[model samples]
Target: MSTKTPTEDDILRPIKNTTSKWFVLFGIAGLAFGLFLIGWAYQLMYGLEVTGLSDWGSGGGVTWGLYIGAFIWWVGIAHGGIILSAAVRLLGMERYMPVARMAELLTIGGLSAAGFYIIVHMGRPDRMVTSVLGHYHITVHNSPLVWDVTVITAYFVLTATYLGLTLRYDISRMREDLPSHFSPVYSALTYGYTEEEDEVIERMVWWVAAAIIIMAPLLLHGGVIPWLFALLPTYPAWFGGIQGPVFLSIALTSAISGVIIISAAFTRAYNWDHIITEDVFRGLLLWLGFFCLMFVWFQLQRIITGSFFAGISGTYATQAMLSSVIYVGALAAVMAVLIFIFAQALRPSLFTKTRALVAAVFVLGATLFEKTFFVVEGFQTVEFSIYEGVPGPYFPSLIEMSSVLGTIGMVTIIFLLVSKVVPVVELHAVEHLQEGHEPEQEAPQEVEA
Candidate 1:
């Protein structure tokens, strides 16, 4: 049986086909983003008090709250998504090429959300800019927060450049089919484009991927973000050698889950099931399951180390973990589902796309809950020098919750708008589909070795 090859027209369907459903979706996202801006304005006028965050030594309240938790979550997603995209390209994982551009888009959206949260969390956005710019030379070397800003900014630039370079290739190919309104943007993006430039652009992208692979694990997610928490010895839960790996694992799991959700949505909306095939879903699921398993292992390591005849801080960390029955149960349930899905994969008749998608949803939810719990609970176990009292339970205020919703809305809006402008699916992926390449049957022995 011959598979249908996707033509340039098919690749450019999103640009050519402007449907009511797209308008409705874009409208909803725009509305949510508008509401978010309003909520942010309200926050600015009111102050940080509008949210659940409280300063240390002030009525025995925790400093960081939902915003910081969300900051970490978004940053992790950005880091992991870009890492996956880079890794797939670097490792020659053609099986995932269909979803590579989508993953790259996730990196952009996630980083944008993360940057927005940093501003929102400050409550004084102007001050944040002034302070960073004024003290960059003085604090860049000494401050973890500054270091985080540096790496995140660098990562964002790298990912964006990688995406832009790749887009130039795609846009040049589809320049004729693209809408008239996009002519200016296309010309700007593809300025001085020629057929000979393709190889040069490919080499540039490969080097960028190589740099990202090095920086992501060594400097960004695995270094600065985790160090923000781990370096603080006062918070026993956050401070440890394992914090980096644990955080990286969560990032990967959440990022993979995010890609699965996005791919499924695109498949449903665009009816590109043939291009975004079951093989793509299966590869992502396998990676997600592996990360979820690693997450459980890291949690066990954390629990055992903290609970074995531990001190006040260690005991506090262990107790915090034990007390969160909901978190533990959610993690366990997701793990079990992933395991079952893997089992079903062995027997093709038992496997279903919906099952994998559902598991991805579960992992996404579980990771969010777990990260929030980590942030809140780390603050709860406060090591005070003078004042001594139980810290109050930190419940996010209406404003804080609104901001969360708003940020998510903002991400959706950005993605929807970007999709309208550019092909969500990569041009090379369409060509790959046209070539009718079969999925690899087995791993190479050298790769296995």
Candidate 2:
């Protein structure tokens, strides 16, 4: 590692500099999102029929397809990011402090994408106010969808509070160095700033972290996203206790994989190799391996329960999953990455940043396919074909496909714009890494790693 001392300039480079690369990326993302909006407009004008979703009974096919699948996937990714960030604070995983801000930002972006999918799938934006929000009192009693909305909204508020409290201290100390144009924003964020409140803010953050840890795994809140499907007893594929652990594992894997990809990108783009070092990557990859293993095991648990011990419907869903080339390919991809990660852990010399990035991309893609398939496959019939082959297999329409790319672009834009405004790396992160200050290491964790 280089011996260069950390400074304000190191963290401020992203704000002070706006290079051609940033412009190019922003333009590409904008184009993708713009196309998605055009597609969305077309969808709104025509109706949900343009997307090829159909009724479940005699009408044939499943009503929930790419949009709902993607919704859960994005929500899981969002919840998982906050979960990781919360663990960092609660467990005092200081090695990951540099990434706490990134995870918080990811949660916001992912949640925005997830919430937007609801509007897209609903086909009318006003329905959010009229249908969900206006009548939430009646729906809140029984509708899992409403529960998801409520808890996700609560999650957003909690995350904003957590991030905002952390930001006050950082912004106040570096007010002079941050861009002058954003002064009003900073002023609002730090309006009541004082040195005395620092301790209180830390305690508040700690308690929020504790609350998240408790709530996330329950049948409500973050876990409610999966519970939306799991509670439907008619669908054997979706109904199970295993879904909580399975989805959480996939979520954690997806979130950490995203962090790996983003951490590497920022490190290389800004030349902060010393700050986000090899050790960080190594630790992240190992944790990823552990979670990936859990993902596979939980997946196995679902498959076994569905395939052997269940009714005809469950078996049919299992059969469909096993037979589908896309489904098998997704599992294979995850397995391949898991094997590589395990091998690298044993043979340290085999590890490389490029390889780690590849593993992350593989897991991300695999999880997306797996979740989308899980939702779609859950609706397929096990008893008999009601349509007698009249209705074709459910596939995402062109518009649906575009929505996926578009939402991804939207998230990219969110991160790109936010980097220009806030310091993506916390000021505390730099202080921890400054010369002559070695972070305290907990020896027990080393052996576990």
Candidate 3:
């Protein structure tokens, strides 16, 4: 018997269905993004003085504030999103195949948001770009910022290419059934496609996934990002070898939380519960718990190491960690509860999707707060001799806060628009499910002569 294939209509339902709710969400996101543009224009006109960032010596404030913190957070989300998708592919975790496309989209959206933060952070983005382009060699080797730019750009290209290549298979398979408006895009995606090309593209994507898995944990978040903080000897709280692992753990935690949030939203809005499934949520929740455990472990290590010393920097670092006790405690408590709930989920009747979703939201908020506190508090407590009696008042300005909201809005808009263009759920995965459900045909009996 032949197995039934998933129809293009099924995959394109999200695009075809134009509900009032979609309009409401899109309108809100567009409005917020417009506000973000306005905020940037205001900054351009008034200069960096409108924000709280300042030169430590001249103004007695932190140069990197909410923007840098947000940068780190968005970068982590991007790295984590790709890692999740790669893990599902590389590890043969077919159960997660349904969510892989969503994760990849998250990576793209997250990176876009992160890049926007970098532009916003640079008070004079044009000058920064001109200088970098003009004197490329001067800073490429010596500057960690240049290294970050290099890695982020490379990763973005690699990811986008991976997504584009993979879409060829889906687009070609669904060519006849796709909407007329999508024909141009489908043609571009499936140009020069053949049955033989699928294998080649699959192999290429596998290698790309492999590259991302290695580069993300080792080079991006684990190496360059942490080094930005750890290499600075002046910032005692950030100066440590363990910073890499800590950041990695936090990245995974936040990424998983983000996935959970998106998945929950899609399930609720589109009634995609049948496709997304409960197992996916449970699996993601368990992984989220594991990373949260790692986060707590790393925090303990930092606290112990810092509090062990009597030096001013060490003492101040300890104080900073202690000062954010509520966030840490909340994170730890949520992790523990999730661990228990995940265990209970394995056996029987106690598993509720809402509980896991609630836990994920809590973890996301707690992690963001903890990270922002880490950045701001590190600067708040100064140990340098020259800046001894200076008052360091660093709070996010109205513009900075608006920019944050705007970036979030931008991410939402990106996801919404992209979903209209492509199937958020992988078509192959849907086909696989159909195959599993196909009825088996028995062999025919021999005819009597």
Candidate lDDT values, in order: 0.82, 0.85, 0.80
**Candidate 2 residues 281-354, lDDT tens each?**
88889999998999889888877887886887788788878899988898999899999999999999999989
lDDT of 2: 0.85
Give the range where candidate 2 is weakest over 10 consecutive residues by summed lDDT.
Answer: 382-391
- For candidate 3, the per-residue lDDT at 321 reads 70
C-alpha lDDT of residue 110 in model 1: 92
State the lDDT at 205 in candidate 1. Answer: 94
* Tens-digit per-residue lDDT, 213-252, candidate 1: 8987777888889888888888887888898998899899
Better of 2 and 3 by lDDT: 2
TM-score comparison, 1 vs 3, better candidate? 1
Q: What is the model-wide C-alpha lDDT for candidate 3?
A: 0.80
Best by TM-score: 2
| Candidate that beats the other on TM-score, 1 or 2, i.e. the better one | 2
Model 1: lDDT to the true structure? 0.82
Candidate 1 is scored at a TM of 0.93
- The best-first sequence of candidates by TM-score reads 2, 1, 3
Worst 10 residues of 3 by lDDT: 1-10
lDDT ranking from best candidate downward: 2, 1, 3
